[model samples]
Target: MKSRKTRVLAVLLVLSLLGAACSKSSDTKEKKKTEDTDYEKHSMETKESTEETTTETTEPSQRDTSVRPVSTPTPTPEPIPMLTAADIQSMNNNNALIVYNEVGNVSTIVGRFFHRPVADEDDAINAIKGVQELLGLQTGYFPFAVYGERFQGYTVYTYQQMKEDVTVTNATLKIVLDQEGYPCMLQSSLASNLDYTPSSPTITEKDAEEIVLNNMGSGYRVLSEYTMTTVYTDYAKAQHCYQVYTNSLIDNASFDMPYIVHFISLDGEYINAYPTAFLPTDPFADYGQDSYFKDMVPTDYSFTINVNGNQVDITIPISKNNVDGKYYLCDPDRKIIVADYYSFEFKGQLKFDTQDDPNSFDAAHMVNYYYYTQAYDFYKEFNIESTDGFGMPILILDGYCDESGRAIKNCCNMGIQYGWSVFAATDGYSFGHSLDLVGHEYTHGVTFYSKQGVQYYNEYGAINEAYSDIMGNIMEMYMGETSDTEWAIGERSGDECRSMSYPYKHYQPMYVGDLYYISTSPLSYLSGLDDKGGVHDNSSLLSHMCYYLYMNGMSLEDLTWFFLASIEMQTPNADYDDFYAIFVASARMTGHEEIIPLLSDYWESTGLKGPREQTAENTTLEGYERINIPFYSAKVGAYCVVEVYSVALGGRYLYTTMQWDGIATFLAPADGTWFLIGITEFSDASLSTKVSEKWLNHDLTAWTDDPNDLGYIVFESGKITTFPTYQ
Candidate 1:
C-alpha cells in the first residue's frame, strides 16, 4: 500500500512539474541577503532553492504521456538532463522569470529552466552561469553565492552575496532546475549601476555619535550606558551612509547592555539603519587573532576575602558585566528582568555584594559557567565566535523567562536566539545550570544563526532542536565528568535525560517513519501535541543515531558534519527531504561516506526517505483548504514585489506577484499560515551585491536603460502580516 501510494504521488509530482513548465512562467523578485550581517535574529527562509512552481493538478491519466517517478532516490542517482521538446517549449514561454520594474538597483532571474543534477555543487553553479550567459547579461553583474540546492528531481538553488565580508541587500538570485537538474526557472536581482567611489564621509565618528545621542528619545537618553563604537558604511534606504555600532544599557539595572546600530548621513542626519530589525553584529568581527587560552572565554571572578565580617571565597553568576568589579553578560535588549516567582526582589543582578544570597551566587555562578564555556567551545571547535558569528553577546536571563522577562518557577527552560541574543531561563537552577543543558540551549542559537540556519524553523526547525539536543549529548559524552556523562537533553530540568541510545525508553519515537512521525505544520505540532510536535520528542531518532555512531566510531570530523551541513544549506524552510540530502551531501563532503549506510539504515527505519514527492495541492492532506490573499497597497508599483510563503519548513513558496496600486492577489497553494514578504528592495545580501556586483563591478557610477529603474506605491493587506519595510 505504501509503495502504491508512493507511485501515485510520484506520478502527480511529475505532472505538476510538467504543467508548471508548460505555463508561461511568471517569476519572483530575486532578493538575496547574505548571512554576514544577520545576527542571532529571525533566521533565514523556507525558500528552498529552485522550488518547482506548483501548477493546478490534473487527473493522473490525463497528464503527461510519460509515467516516471518524479523524485526517486536510488543508491546511485542517474545523472541525466531529462529534457524533452515539451520542456524546451515550456522554457521559451517562461524565459525571464524575474520581474523588474526598472526601479530598484537589483537583478534576478527566476522561472523554469531545463537542468541535470551535477555530482558536485561547483558543476551545478557552472550550469547556472551558463544560463546567465545565454540571457545576454554579464555573469559578474549578478553577484550571488548559492546558499542551498535540492539534489533530487527539480533541484533549486538559493544564492546570496557576501562581498568584502559584509552582507549585500536588495540583490538575490534563485535558479530552478528541471527533473534532470538543469536550470529552468530563475528569480534573482543584481544592482545595475552603483556609485562605489567610497564617497568621502562628510561626517566624523564624533558627529555621528552626537547625532545618535541627540535623536535617541526618553528611556534611551542615559548617556553613560552607551559604549563600544564602530564605524562602517551602511546601505538600507538604497543609499550608502556611515553607521555606528555600540552597546547601550537599555535598563539602569546594569551597565553595558544590548547592542544597537545608529546610522548617520553624510549631511549629519541620524539614520535608523535597520528600521524594522535588530542591528547586525560588528561588521569587522569575522576575523581576529586566535588565542587558545581559557581566559578568552568570559569567566566569573572568584576570590577569598573578608567582606561583611567573614572570610569567604565566593563565585556566582547572574547577568553582570563588571558590576562592582565582577563580570556578567546580561540581556542587552533590557527585555529580561527579575521574575515574579523567585524568592528575592531581583532589582539589579546579584552584584558583588557579600550580603547577597548564597543561592543567588550559586545560580549565577553555575549558569554563566555553562553558558560561557559552551560558547567558547563552539568558537574553538567550529570557528563560530558568537551566536551569529559576529560577537553578539550570549544574553542569559537568569531566573527569568525570556519571552516574559519574569521569573516563573520553571518557565521556558531552553536556549533561544531571542532578539539576536541567547535568552535562557535560570529555571531555579535546574537544566539551566547543567553544562549539557547550557550547551544544548546555546547550540540552538548557533544552529538558528548559522548560515544553514536559513532553514531553521519547521522540519528543519525540528532538526534545529535536534541539533541542539545532539550537541548536548555529544558534549556530555566528550566533556562531561564521569558522574555527569549521559546522552540526554534537559536532563537536570526533567530529572532525566531523553535517552539518545533508546529514545522509545523515554516515550519518544526512535525511528523516523513511526506512526507518530511529523512532517508538516510545525505550529500545529507545537500547539496540538506534546514536545512541540516532537521537536524534543522526535529528536530522539536522530540523537539515537548520533549515539550509535559515537559508540561505534565518530571523530571531530564526524561531529563537524552537521556544522558543515548548516553553513552550506541555509534553506529557511527546509524539511525531512532537504535534511537527508544535505546530511548525505555533508557526509560525502567530509569524507565520511562510510556513514551513508548507517544513515540509510537509521532514516529508513523511521520511514523518512529524503523528500516525499507530493504537491502542496494534495487534497488528501488534512486541513487542506486553499485561500487567496488579496494584497493591495496604494503605494506599490513596478519597483515593488509581493511574495507569500507557507510559514512552515521548506517555506513553501505560495505565490509571488506585482501590484500596480499595491494589489497583487495570491492564490495560496495549501492551508495553514502564510507569511507575506513585501520588498521594495530585499534580503540582507542584496545591499552588498548592489555595491560590489553592480556599482563596483567596473567602478562605474551609472548604467542606462535598466528595467529595474522604476518606483514604489504604498501597499497594505487585510491580513496584516510581518514584512520588511522602507521608512
Candidate 2:
C-alpha cells in the first residue's frame, strides 16, 4: 500500500510540473504575438514612407502642394467732391429761399440763431416770410436761402406755404419768422423805410446839412464820417457823419460849472448830444458844489477832435474848479450814451505842488485815479455809457503816501468807528490794496443795509468774515487780478498785515503749536499773546476752515450756499459744534446729503469722540423678555463689563466666579448663557474700581485642566458664577 501511495504522489507531482510548463508556454506565445504585431505595424509604416518617397521622386513640382498661394487685390477709395458758393446759392434759389447779402441785414438772423437753431426747411422758409410780413412786403412766391457759408454763398430756399408764427420787434429792430420757422431781417434801408414813413418831402443831403448847421450853431463841426451799406436785392449806401460843437456858456468851464455841449449828427441830422461836465456829475454834485468849489469860473480853454471810422476822440481844456481844489475836465452828460467815441484820450494830468500845500495830492487821490481809469476802460471797450454819472473820481494829493501804516490805520479806524468798512493797505501793505478790498467793503455796506443792525459774534462773526473774504477773492477774480490773492494781506507793510494763506507764517504767538489746543490752559500759557481780545484767535479757525474748503475745490456756488446757511441758521452765541451742525443742515438743504457721512468720517478720523448710548437685557424662566438693565460702557477687550444694578425677576443672587482658563468656555444658567471672561492681571478691591473691573477672580479649573477639549460647563440652578484670571 505504501508503494502505491508513493507512486500516486509522484504522478501528481509530475502532472503539476507539466501544467506549470504549459502555462509558461502559453505566456511566451502571447508575448511573441504582441512583438509580431508591432513589427508588422512598423513594416506597414515603412511601406507608406517608401510610396511617398516614390511619388515625390516621380514629380518634384508636386512637393510644393502644401497650400495654394492667395492673391489679394488692393481696394480703391472713393473721392470726396468739393462745393462752391455759386452751387450753394443755386441750390437755395432752386429751393425758393430768400437770401440776405448785406452783413448788417443779417443781424436779426444772427440774433435768431443765438436764440434758436433752424429745425428744418419749413422753419427756414417761415423765418423769411416773417421778415417780409414785418416789412409789409408783398407775400409773393418768396423763397429764402440761409447760406450756411454766410452771405458769401448764395443758398436759396422757396416757401411753398406760409406758416403762422410769432414776431418780436424791439425799437428799430424787426425780426420775422418765415413759413419754414427761421428768422430773417430786412436790409437797413428797407427797415428804415418801414420804420419811418417819409412824407412828400424832397430833402437833399446839402439841405439836410444846412438844417443841422442852423439848429446846432456855427461852432459845430463834422467829426467823423461813415458810409452805411445794405444789400436786399441790390446794394444801398448812405452817408453818415458825426458832428461836435462847444457851447460858449458851458465851454472852458471848471469843475464847478457845466462844460460846453457837444452835439453829434448822423447824415446831417441831429441824433445825440452831451457836455464835458457829464463825467464829473457825481463828484461835482457831492463835494465840488459845497466845500471845494463855491465860486469857480473858466479861465481859458481849447478843443481838439480826432475822427476815425465811426469813432471820434475829443480833447478839451478847462480851468480848475478852484485854485485850492483839484481841476477836472469830464463829460458827464454823454457818459450814459452809447456814442461812437470808442475812447477819450485824456492826455492832460492835474499838477499839484507839495510845497504849495501838504494835502495837495494824497494817496487816496492816486487810488481814486486807478479805480476811475479802470472803470472808464471797462465801459469804453463795450461802448457802454455811464448812465448814472457814476464815474469814479480821481483826487490827486501831493506827498509821500505811506500805504502801509497811514492808509491801513485810517481804513481800520474808519471801519470800526463809523462802520465804514474801508478797504486799504495794512501799514505799508499794497498787495491787499486792490479792487477786491473795495468790493469787500462795498459788500459789507450792502449787507449792513440789507440786514438792518445785526452785530457779528461767534458763528455770525465767523460767517461775516468768511463772506467778506470770499467776496473779496471773487471780486479780484472778476477783475482779472489773481496774482495778489495769496493769503498774505500786505507783504508791503513790512510786518503789519495779516497773512491769509498761512496765518502761522507771521509767527504770531497765538497760532503756534497744535491748533486744536491753542486755546487750552498749558498751551495758552506757553504763548502769552492775547489774540486781539480773542477775535483774531477764534477767527483764525474760520479762516483756516474756509481755506481748507477752498483748497478742496469748493465752487463759488457751494461757498455761497454755505454762507447763506451759516448766516441764516447761526445764533449769536453759537460754538464750533453749532457751526458744524449748521453746516451739515445747510449741506443737506443744498442737496449735498452725501457730505454728512463724509463730515462724520472726517471728525472720527481726527480722533474726536462723539456721543453714544448702550443698553442690556435679561430673560425670565417663563421665557418672557424683560428689560433688566440700562447701563453704558466703552467697548473694551473681548467682552463688555456691565455693572448689574438690580434684578427685575426673582432669582438666586449668588455671587459666583468663572474664568477663561487657558481657553475660553461658556457656562449655561437656568435663564441665560454666561461667558467665562478672561483677565491678564489681578487687582485688589479698591484698586479694581480704580483700574479696570475685568481682573476679578472666579472658578474655571475644568477648562484649564483640558483646554484643548473646548468643552463647556453647566452651572446648577443655585450655583454662583464668577470670572477668574486666566492661568
Candidate 3:
C-alpha cells in the first residue's frame, strides 16, 4: 500500500491526466481574483523521454469470421506512409474496427496497426503527429500527459489531450505496443476541429467563482484549487469555459450534494451546472423507508442487533485503541473504519462504544461495518487492494445530515481526496444496510481507479452508473441469502428501486432512444437538471445489453470477469460504439470470442451498429436537385451528412436536419458534376453513408459525358436526372 502523501500525489497525477484545468484547494479561505488569473496562466508539462524503441511484429489471433470477416494484412516494409481516415477505414477487419463520432471526429479505433514501439514521449508525439495530419485532427488538441504500462508482454501508452493549457474533458489517445515494442493498436476520442473561437475572457476567475458560489446557494463553496479553465462540448458545440468545481462545506451532506461543475462562458455568463459526482443508484430517486438484514459472516464481535424493524444476529471485526483501551468500529485487517456523524466521532470509546450489543441508530454503524466488509471481500476476490489500490482505509460516516440537521437520506463515495469516505443516512432503511447498495457505492471507487476512469456525465457517465448497478446486483446474487430478486437493485430497501431486466418498469430506457430516453441537449439538460445529461436514465440501455447476454446463456461468473476486465480497456469519453469495439476486443483478448456474435447482433438490434452499405437502386428522377436519402436513425437519434466531391473543387460538405419520418433531405451544391458520399451522426459517434462501390473511386471522365453513368449524379436543367437506390 502507498502512503497517504504518495496516494494523493498519484491521484493528482491522474487528475492532471484527466485534464483537470484548475487547482482546487482544501482550504476554506476565499481566493482573490489575481490569484485565479495566475492559476489560469500556469501550465504543467506531462511528457517524459526514453532511449530505446522496439520494432517487431507477430502473428494475429483467430477471430469469429461468421460475425465479421477477418482479413490478414500483408506486412509493410520500412518508412510507413502517414495514415488517412480512408486508409484507416480500409484497414477494418474482424479484429479491427474504427468508429467516428458526430461532426466527423475519429471517436474510436481498435486493432493492430503497423508501427515501431515509441522509445519516449517524443517518439509518441511524432507517432501521433503522423496520424493526426492525415486524420485531420485539429489544433487545440495537444498531448499533456503520457503513461506507459505492461500488459500481456506488451507496452501500452496512453496520452491525455489538452487544449490551450486547459483540460479537454474526455479527449484521449491510446497507443498499444507489442512485446517487442511494435505498435499493436491505437484508440482515440480527441476533438476533430476548432469550430469554436478562442479569445481572452471578459471576466476573472474570482468572478466566475462567485457566480458558481451564488448558484450553489449559501452553504456551498468552490474548491478553488480544483477550479480551472476547461474545454467542454455542450451538445455538439464546443465551448471554452470555466469549470467551477463546487461542493458542500457540511461534513455529512447528502449524496445529492456531490461535486458539481458550474460551467461559465468567457463573458461571465453562466452556461450551466450539473452534479459531476458518480454513485450507484439514482441519486434523484425517492428512497423507500424500509430496511432489512440477511445472514451475516459471524466474527468475534458478536451481537444481536435490530436492523430497521427486524432483529438479526451478526458478528464483525473491530479494533480497540491502544492507549484508551476502548473498542471502536474499526477493522485493521480490511483497513476499514466507521464513524458516527451524530457525535462527530469514530464510535471512539464514547457512549456504547465498548458495548457488545448497541441498539437503535448505533446498530446502523454495525450494519455498515458488516456489509462494508462484505463488499470489500467481494472485491478482494479480484485482488483489488482497496478503492485506491493502495490499501487505504475505507471510511464510512453513518447518519449524514444537512445544515438543518435533517438526515440526507442518501449515500455517496466522497472521493479519494476526502479519505475515500462513503457516507449514508441512518434514517429508515439506511443505504449502508443493503449489501448491493454498499457494493454499488464501492464500485464507484473501482471505476475511479480503473485505467480510463469513466466520466460521471453524458454517455460515459451513463455507462459508469450501469456498471455499478450491474455489479451491485451481481454481489447480491453471489453473497446475500438466496432469493428471487436477481436483477433488481435496492430490493432490500423494500421498493425495487430499479429493475435491470425490465428497466422501463422503473421509468428508465431499456434501449437507446426509447420512451424514457433523455436528450443530451445542453439547453434541456442544464435548465432541467436532467440527471447529469441523463446518465441515470440512459444507463439502462447499456446495462440491458449486459443483462441480455447474461440471460441468453452466458454464465454469471464469466459475465462478471468480462465486464471487470473490460473496464481497464476503455478511454474517458468512450460511448456505446467504443464499448462495442472494446467489448469485442476484450472477448478476443480473453478467449471469449464465441460471445462476439451474440453481442454484435444485440448491439445492432439496439441501433448501436449499422450495416455499412445500404443497397442502392439505379433510378432516373426528373426536375429535382434534392435527394430523399433513407437512413436508420430511429435508434441512434443522429443526423446525416453528404460529402460531394467535384474535379473543379476538391470537396464540399453539405448538412441537413434529421427527420423522425426516416428520411433526410440533402440538397446538392448546385448544378455540377459531383461524386457523392454520405455520413450520419449518433449520440456519441457517427456512421458512414451506406453505399455500393459503383459511386466511389471512379474516374470523373467515365461519368462526365454519360447521363447513364450510375457512378455520378448530374444536375442538368436545374434537376437531378440520375439517382442511386439508398438505404
Candidate 4:
C-alpha cells in the first residue's frame, strides 16, 4: 500500500507538474497572441495618425474639409425714396434753389420777375437760389444771374442740380432789366428731381393789347394796323415783343412818307410792313416832350430788295447831257427812269415818265428801281457818320440814255485799258452786252482787292474770268433769278458768257480766235472795242479749266491752291509756260496729288509741257596732283576755300572754314575718305575755269555730250580733293 501510495503521490506530482506545464504554455500562447495583435493594431494606428497629420499640413485651408466651410455674403443696398408733389413744390419755392421753366406761364412770370434789377451779387444769388430750391435741388449748389444791359430789360437765371440725389450740380440764372430798372424777364435752368409739366401762360388778347399800349405811352402814332397769325406759344410771344419794340414809330413822316417796319426774330424769321399814305406831323411847338417822339421816330425806309434777274431788266438810261456826248449822257427832267425790268429778256420799251405806281412799269422796271433805291440806302446808312465811309468814290449816273451794249463796251474797254470800273446795262440790242459784261468788270475790282495784283494771263486770267462769271451767277441767284429766264446771257448769246461746265461754248472764231493772237504778243495793244484784253479766245480756255476743276469735286479751298501758288510764285511777266511750271510746283508742294494730274492734262491740252526735270547727286573734290594738295591745303587758311567740285553744269561749290582750339583746320581733303590732316584755315578757289581744268586734267571727254560738258566731279581718285576735311 505504501508503495502504491508513493506511486500515487508520484502520479499526483506528475499530474500537478502536468497541470502547471499546461497552464504555463496556455498563458504564454495567449500573451504572445495578445502582444502580436496589439503590435499590429498600434502600427496601423501610427500609420493612420501620420497620414492625417501629413494631410492636415499639406492641404490648403480652403480645400481642407476638416475646417469650417465658407459661403458668399450678400451686400446690403440703399433704399430709393419717393418724392412727393408737395416736397417738389416746397423745393421750387425755396429761396436758395433755382428752377427752370421750359414752357408756359412760369417762363413769362420768371421773365417778368428777372426784369427788375437786383441790388448786388447776394440779392442776385439769393433770388436765383430761391428759384433753385423751389425747383427741388439739394443743398451745396446755387444759381448765378445774368443780366443784359444792351437790350435795356432782359434778365435770366440758370442753375443745375444732380438728378439722382437732389444734389445741386449746375445752375445759371439771368435777369434782364430795362433802362428804367424794371424787370423784363427771368430765365433759369437747373437740375431737378421733379419732371417738368408745361402750362400755358394766361395772357388774354385784351391784356396783351393793354401791355402794348402801356409800353408805348403817349404820342405813339399808328401809321398802319396789321394782324399776325401766331401759334399761342412762349416763343411766339417773345418774338412778338421783339417785333413790336423794333417796328413801332411815332410818326410816318420821320421815315420819309413811306414808313416801313421790319420784324425779325432771333430765329431768323422776318416780315415787313409799310404805310400806304403820308404820315400826320405834330404841329405843337417844340417842347421837352419832343425828345420822346424823336427817340421813337423812324429813320429812312430800309429794305433788302432782291431784283429778279429772270423777270427784271436792268437799264442805266443815259440822258442828253453836254459832257463828252459820246462818253456821257444826262437827263434834265429825270425822265429816263433807271428801272429793273424782269423777264427772260428786256421786252418793254424805255419809259421816260416818273410814276411811283409799281403796276405802271414792267416787273423788271419796278424791281430794278426797288433794288437801286435799297442799294443806295444801304450805302447811305453805311456812310452816315464817317469820312469816305462809302469805300472809295462811286458815281451813280441816274436817268442816263445810252445803248446798253455801247455802255458795256466803253466801260469794259476803259477798265481793261485804264482800270476803270463801270456798271453797264444789258439790253438785248447788243451782243456781249449782258450781265456777264458787268460781272466781268466788277470781278476785276474784286480780284484786285482779294488777290492783290494776281497774274492776269493764261491760267490766272482764265480762273479770274471764271470766278467773275460764277459771281455773276451768284448775284443773279441773290436777285431771285433763275436760268429759265431769257436773261441767261451765257446760254443765250451763243455761249459768250460761260457755261456750267464748258466755257468753249462761247469760243467763236470771230470773237475769240483773232483776239488770242493780239493778246499773246509781248507788245499787244488794246482796242477798247472788245471785252477781253485782246485775248478773248483764251479766256474760254481759262474759264473752262476752272469749270472743270469745280466740277471735279474740288472745294473752294482746293481751287484757291492754284490761285495762291500763282499769286505767290508767278513773276509779274509770267506767261502760260511759267504758269505751268508754277502750277506743277505748287501742286506738288501743297500735297495736292489730284491737281498734279489735272495740271499735267491741262498743260498737254494747251500744247505745252509741265515743269523742268531735276537731278540730284553727291560730288567730291580731289587733289589735282600730289603737289597740288599743298596748294589746296594752303588755301585752307584763306577766306574763300573750295569745298566740293560738283560735276553738273553750272554747279555751285560750297566753301567754309572754321577755327578749332585756335587751330586752322583744313576740311578739303578730309571728305570722302579717312586721312591725316593738320590744322589750317580754308579759302575758295578763284579759278573760273575749274570745269575746263578738271576736264583737261582728267581726260573726261568720253562722257561728254559736248566738249564743254563738265559734269560734276563725283570723286577724285577715291580721295576727297573737292571738299575740305577737318580733324
Best by TM-score: 3
Q: Write the per-residue lDDT of candidate 4 for residues 345-446, one digit (tens) a residue.
A: 122232232333322333323333333333323223222110111122222222222223122212221111101112223332222223443444444444
Off by over 4 Å in 4: 1-422, 426-437, 450-467, 470-489, 492-500, 508-519, 526-534, 555-574, 578-593, 608-727
| Estimated TM-score for each candidate | 0.43, 0.28, 0.65, 0.28
Kindly indicate the candidate among 3 and 4 with the higher lDDT.
3
Q: 1-727 in candidate 2: lDDT tens per residue? A: 0000000000010111000111111221121000000000000000001111110011111212122112211112323223222332343333211223222232112112212334433344333343443323443222211111111011122111111110001111122222223332212112222232223324433444455455544454431111111111111121122223222222110101112222223334443232221111111112221122233433323322211122222222222444555444322222111100001111122232222332232333334223333333433222211211122222212121121212212221011111011122222233223544433433343233222112232223333444554554544454554455565432322223344566666432222112211221111111111221123334444555555565567664455445543333332223343344445544543445555555444334322112100000111222222211111221221222222211333332322111111112221334554323223221211112233333222344321323343322233443323333233
Residue 504 accuracy (lDDT) in model 1 = 63
Q: How does model 2 score by TM-score? A: 0.28
Kindly report which residue stretches of model 1 are placed more than 4 angstroms away from their true locations once superposed.
1-128, 131-365, 402-406, 409-420, 452-457, 482-486, 492-494, 513-515, 522-532, 561-568, 610-727
| Native-to-model Cα distance after best TM-score fit, residue 191 in candidate 3, in Å | 4.3
1-727, model 3: which lDDT tens digit per residue?
1101111111011233343333333453533211000001111111112333332322111211123112112222346467765555444433346665544445555554444556644455555655765435765555455445443343556655555555566566666554455454556756666445787889877889987765545677666655667776542245677777765442332133356667788788777665555321111111221110011122356777555466667778855555455566666667676664555322222132344333222666787778888878777665555764445456666666654566666666654433333444454446666777777778877765553334565566677888888887787677753264548777665545677888878898654444355434332233323454467777787788777888777776667666765665677666676677767655644446778778777776654453211101111123325444444444332323334556456665543333333443443545556555434332221122332222322333221223344344454433422233233
Among all windows of ten consecutive residues in candidate 1, which has the lowest summed lDDT? 1-10
Ranking of models by lDDT: 3, 1, 4, 2
- The predictions' CA RMSDs to the true structure, in order, are 20.7, 43.3, 16.7, 44.3
2 versus 4: better lDDT goes to: 4
- What lDDT does each candidate get? 0.37, 0.27, 0.53, 0.27
Worst 10 residues of 2 by lDDT: 33-42
Tell me how far the alpha carbon of residue 293 in candidate 3 is from the true structure, in angstroms, after superposition. 29
Best by lDDT: 3
- What lDDT does candidate 3 reach at residue 351? 30
Alpha-carbon lDDT of model 2: 0.27
